[model samples]
Target chain A: MKSEVNTVNNNISSLAQAKPLASPAVQIDFLNSDDLIKFETKLESSALYPLVSSDIDIFQVNLGKMCNQVCKHCHVDAGPDRKEIMTKETMQLCLDALDSCNISTVDLTGGAPEMNPNFRWFIEELSQRGKHIIVRCNLTIILANNKYHDLPDFFAKHKVEVVSSLPHFSAKRTDSQRGKGVFEKSIEALQMLNAIGYGKADSELRLNLVYNPSGAFLPDDQKGLENEFKRRLKNNFDIDFNELFAITNLPISRFLEYLVDTEKYEDYMQELIDAYNPEAAKGVMCRNTISIGWDGFLYDCDFNQMLDLKVNTASQHIRDFNAEDLHSREIIVNQHCFGCTAGSGSSCGGTTT
Target chain B: MDNSYYDPKDLKKFGNITEWQPKLGEKFFDYYGEVFKEGALTAREKSLIALAVSHAVHCPYCIDAYTSDSLKKGADEEQMMEAIHVAAAIKSGAVLVHGVQMMNKADDITM
Candidate 1:
């Protein structure tokens, strides 16, 4: 397999493979593809139905795929060239659904959720409804534009929970995965966030840092890694944050290409398989979350959303959302689900165990 | 027969040592496990020390194992590299300090 680094010349052409197929008829195969199906069957033998949604507590919206930076492990293959941005109509649909469903959290994600032109309007609506809003910020977005400089203050004003991905506290590891000068900008963004009492004690403005492994390895214990991050960030830069979330990299999009390019796909898959925990599987995020694409299409979770695997229901769009049917829908699982069940387990918020 | 001195394949078979000699291999494994267990220092600290020593001895296998071990134990790349530098500095000093012995022998023989 060839590396897509050179081919991705800041355009949509780069995402020829990374883009999710329009229809479910296309079969996506990774290294040892059969293992995913067999693993699901193995769970059934143990009387465990691991892939089923219990309730819909989170309404995760992918604002679009227009990001400033093109990360190597980005599952969405989001970059500047991608033109898909959620419009005002879709935002209204999301707001209506949230109002009717009484969802607890409205997770806003994107190439950069803030990149969307209607980001402020969408958040204002969500906040007006008294819904807890979580922005899956990419850190660099805070410093990407001059207009975005006031976002930390904006977030604090709205009492929004910010979950930013900071792969590692160290500049070398972080820049290698993100981009050159990214660590500096991210640190600056973090400092700006801290100044507004985001991560400060007794402050309602909650700030969380996310840690994804730079390579094809599982993250360390969340509590231990959080302590280490807090110590290092504080001792080195006088920066403080709330908590660290360790998310396992699912095999999809550019990460899948990377696994194939490095020839570690089979080994990595086996590692996830051998480390499967039923306890972890029980608490998989898909059980309580519904992911909405930029176009208002619905998915079981973020990974399934990336894979273009729509929910296994006739009402596959948020415009047609029925809480009763969606809550009881069987989660559409595949080999990628193993990434969530391995070892300590992983989710958008943090570790399951 | 495989002619290479170090079969890249054998590294993957480290856990299969008991297949050759079950009794002594098991004993050695037990002792190795005990040596790595936490006492005063943490398993993380021990892994860092192991990573430093692995570089000093120039054993690729040990270096690979300890690098992964150290990362898994929550040691960052910065600390791991620092440990390696410590090993490198000490190894170089050991070689340089031995020049005193060489000088003493030369003086005794020549004088």
Candidate 2:
């Protein structure tokens, strides 16, 4: 009964309009491949067989995939529509492991960690246990909803170390990587955090910003980029942060799709492979960190966690936590490990050397 | 053995310029290296300038090299695009400004 000519336009929400940007171009097995393994062998000493862990000092927990913004380069493919979340039971199990496993830092991450319903409860428990809590916050989340408006105050109260991702100090670059209006919200959120003494001199309320390259390349000198970010942010927005962490974009999920879409997958992979630094490889974060997914599965690193490459061990869940076994287990690796080992190396904490 | 004027493989043999005139080629490379080093302008700024000039000169090899170099030097997409626009505007203006010569010639020859 409608007219042939259109009148008022009906459109879907951005979230509804969202679909994955990257898809596998060819049928290729990223894992169990001979090329990456051969490359690793050439880079390693005679003792390199199964890449093993040293000790689990940093326990990173992915709360869920629910996020306010769907970034083009997200490895997790996490968005608002993702209903996966860690249950309180799993959180309790993780807390129990932390108590026994001598874990020093509890690194909490997610599509947006704050979006988790039990985020506060888990943080409170970790804080009470005297664990150094690092919340991998996406700054826009602080300004996403009215309830989240008080996040800065809450973070300050808990003395949580907030590591937020700000792809660039410039609005144009940041918005292109994230979404429209995201850069403004992130700036507002940063200002709020600064007002609460989060990034102040002689303040324990530490606030660090994260930077990842916005394209198919490795990040430049971390210290130089950090200085540029600090100078620009101070001059333009009157903002300050403890430090900037420049992360390399891993070749997985949306980024992999981007590589395939642009026909640069092999070239980019070759670049990473060619730039492999043995010194950087020795300090890869997987040696000391263990990542736990929302559904209780474990991984050597977050990238492995996203790729469903669970920790290479029998006891691969928090419920089956065996400190000795988990600590001694070999790390699960693929070609993507090159991302972390290239140049000065990358991890949740930024450059290795 | 191909008869094509522009061989795709010629781009790969860019380093072989020294084969013909080693001394001059080496000097040109050394001067080129010195010019691109960080000075009053940061490496990033120099890279953007090079990218713009590459577009103006319309050199495919230079364009490709400078595009990657500019990105590695921390130039984002918007900055790169803006640099290209700068090149485009200058190129367009250069051609238009030369049109004044045509106008003068036409007036002087007219009866």
Candidate 3:
């Protein structure tokens, strides 16, 4: 099985870059073209229209778009070919913004945030500020090269909450969605994290794993899946993690391409519509978390950041950093927003309801 | 509406039987939901049983729903295939066991 990364060597751009889908306007148009009820109307019926932030508690920053693998369902369409990376100046701007706000958590995400040159510096700066740091570490990166081999040790030292994606406990299922050999590497990376008290019972180092469906389906009950994951990982490989976050794959970027190509787009949208839960809608992560793009522009959530939907406020950039304006601004929504509100609801922290 | 006897789309309407026969439909659905919950048998185990039963009954909709249900419940390929084989074994055994009846009839009719 060839790694999906090989596509980069063949000179393939991300789905966004290769087609008219690169334009946010086109994606938004495609989402709205569906005959299903509008997302805002559903919110209105639930009395959640004009959804405004409760408060900004988590500041999620995209470090870059360079990754070791090209996952089939990646909403970012991120890969090795992506050259958009946040510079040190942008990192400084983020730090400055954090200073002005009482936001307690900083979430670092990317194609692979560790791929950024300033990633360590940014983490160090955040650590020094006593902010709760969460790194969305793709486990394979810890073993991708010699330089990254020490990542587990570095993460332990900083007490950075290490949340990694391992789609399934089975190798075939996991690799099918992520890549050919991701499961094995992830297991090895997890063992390394476990060896240094990362996910241990007595350790303060928090390690969590993220699980999404391997195909066009919603994930099973998070608690049940976590139990299954714990049993299988412990019996099969002796790995341990604190919690499992079951996330619904929002239709955007490469995943949107997959849905369109496989002709499951309409059916999937209908599934999401049928599973819509109003309780989940009210707790949608976008209401409490703000997403910052690689270059410092802000959005309602990471999915919005990928689709280029800037936050609806005067302080649309990190440099502006107005908590009051952000708190009162209406969140941007379209058909894709349904993914987050479906069933138990999905957020970076797992089910919102 | 089309020529085919089955439409995958109909699976989504499984809940709508209540519109016409509300009381019985509601009762049946409540029973069905209760039957599949975690009991002495884990939901995962029940899902595998459902997959096997789907095959024995030859219900395409059940086959489709239970297969996804089994996977979602974390039943792997080997476990799923083994469950179907359980159904197959019982189905074949039912046919083979009737050979005793055929033998008895032959013995009674023979000279």
Q: Show the lowest summed lDDT stretch of 10 residues, model 2 chain A.
A: A4-13
Tell me the deviation in Å of residue A210 in model 3. 0.7
**Model 1 docking grade:** acceptable
lDDT of each: 0.83, 0.81, 0.89
DockQ values per model: 0.46, 0.39, 0.60
Arrange candidates by TM-score, descending: 3, 1, 2
Cα deviation of A276 in candidate 3 (Å)? 1.1
Candidate 1 residue lDDT tens string, A153-267: 8898789999999998889878877778889999999999998898987788899999988887887678778888898899988889999999999877777767766777777
lDDT of 3 by residue, A245-353 (tens): 9999988877776777677788889889989999999999999998999989999999999889999987689888887778867999888999999999999999998
lDDT of candidate 2 at residue A113, scale 0 to 100: 90
Best by lDDT: 3
Instruction: List interface RMSDs for the candidates, in order.
Output: 1.9, 1.9, 1.1
Clashing pairs in 2: A22-A257
DockQ of 2: 0.39
Instruction: Select the stronger candidate by TM-score from 1 and 2.
Output: 1
